[model samples]
Target: MMTIERLREEINKIDEEILSLLNSRASCARQIGELKQKNSLVTYHPAREKEIYRQLLATNHGPLSYDTICAIYTEIISACRGIESPLKIAYLGPEATFTHMAARRKFGSSVEFVPVASIADVFAEVEKKRADYGVVPIENSTEGVITHTLDMFIESNLTICAEILLEISQCLLSNSSLEEIRLVYSHSHAFAQVRGWLKSNLPTTKCIEVSSTAEASRRAAMEQDSAAVGSELAAQVYHLNIMAKGIEDRVDNYTRFLIIGHSMVGRSENDKTSIMFSVKDRVGALHSMLSPFNKHNVNLTKIESRPSKDTIWEYIFFIDMNGHIEDDNVKEAIDELRESCLYLKVLGSYPVAG
Candidate 1:
């Protein structure tokens, strides 16, 4: 028997209470920030943030889905964290790129986002303290690893603080109709992803390669009868209509981004550790390097090899494994791994991206 008028009145009352609670939370956050500053601690903690999300999601039995709860809390946390200290994050781009999106996903919208020209620029920003952290694409499901990113780690002192896993959905953005489109601008990777779609749909349209999807959208906006293969966010940022969406050859395409910073992240319940090493130049050296992991019952999630730029034909092996470096099993395995390798470096141990 509740009338719409009565329900709206109740909603207004709840909103007022919600505002009050938010202010209280912000006040608490401010106090914590003061303490952190005094003690010389970093503002962001991956494990702490993950614990908050896990607790909220575990208790949620809702009229709203878990995704909805996460979305709401992300903004709320962003606002609260901004009250503490505004973080400056650098990403590869002119804005609206997947790396930008991934940076936003981890830090939220309240922080400052600096879009740079390239992945190396992103690293340089954080290294020089121009930005608090940098987000760069490490690998893509369709195109494989980004070798440049791995190479940067070989010489940089930065640590992997966190990671972001984002699903890539290519969209065709244009000012004109699909039939009127003459040129398509996008990154080489995007072109590779949507090759099949472009072949079938716009076989004759001239495709131009640009630095990024955001740049492509910008070019599409300026040129007549032009389109760009990019993200829906690019469409929004560059003020273009989405002519088509989900145009990638593979529907399951995803990209993994790494958050690099000066501070090391503490361990979480579910964690991943990344390491790089060069095996000794001898028979069965590679096998000897991997045996310790099996002996310690540690699970390796991924392994990739890159040329050691210093020496010809020599390679460095990068690996991702489950568990924190502080864990006894992982620690022991790494000790064993070091014995079989010419050199070993522990990149970081961070909470696995959800």
Candidate 2:
């Protein structure tokens, strides 16, 4: 058996080799980026990324799981992206928000991060090309949907390139002694999700609404008599003590985030397509819009409506289906829906998460 010193030496050699290879890979990527730029092509190619991950997973030998390998490669790719130009990613922020965490998980630490004030800002950044991509929350298992994000999607031309599901754990943070806490601050959604827990544990504490959980954390960090209900990451970001952890009423809480970019991605075997459409204002109009999916045997994963800002009492329906737009059945269904709708837009077709 090798001694500890020998193992350390081997690790150092491997590290040096990895670094050398990475530099070579980055050089190639830079050349590729230059060529793409000459042709006026987009930087992020979701289809290529999906293919790379699929091939890597197929050839993977254990010791590291497929997910672990994919994660490492994602970081490596993000670093190589700088050879083209550092990708600017916008997220709902004030740092340590779940959207920030999702951005990090998806793009790694190499991309330049922009902390935007609202979901609309996130969409606008990508739409205006100020950022290469933007990350925004779309839905939560417990709270249903982020209506603001969906509303923005209906009006934007941006495409969904990827999706990430993050497990949420709401923590109670305070600078005060637990017994001295008289109020708790958090976003309204977080409060609603944890209402039962708050009522049972801190009935006397007043629940205050803030712009965001990160903001709530900041408030709790400053006020000795107050607590903030937020993520564990928010506590660390704001330098507050955790008075309680996992305070959300639901243990299975998870939020789904969408990665939006300027162009549509190529198709993948495991892909999902998102679209928005407005139906005619008549009885069974909505039913007519959905019948095509049933006829074409397309699996509808989600459907939600938001009031159209363009017209009063008129609404836009956002639909998520479990196949790429390139699929024959999906194409047929889209054609049929388009015929029935006043306006329709196929947002994007992108790879599904493993």
**Candidate number of the best TM-score:** 1
lDDT values of the candidates?
Answer: 0.93, 0.90
Per residue, candidate 1 scores C-alpha lDDT tens digits across 119-205 of 899999999999999999999999999999999999898999999999999999999998999999999999999999999999999
Q: Can you tell me which runs of candidate 2 are displaced by over 4 Å?
A: 310-312
User: Once model 1 is optimally superposed onto the true structure by TM-score, how far is the C-alpha of residue 101 displaced, in angstroms?
Assistant: 0.8
TM-score per prediction, in order, is 0.98, 0.93
Q: How large an RMSD does model 1 have?
A: 1.0
Which pairs clash in model 1? none
- How many clashing pairs in candidate 1? 0
Worst 10 residues of 1 by lDDT: 279-288
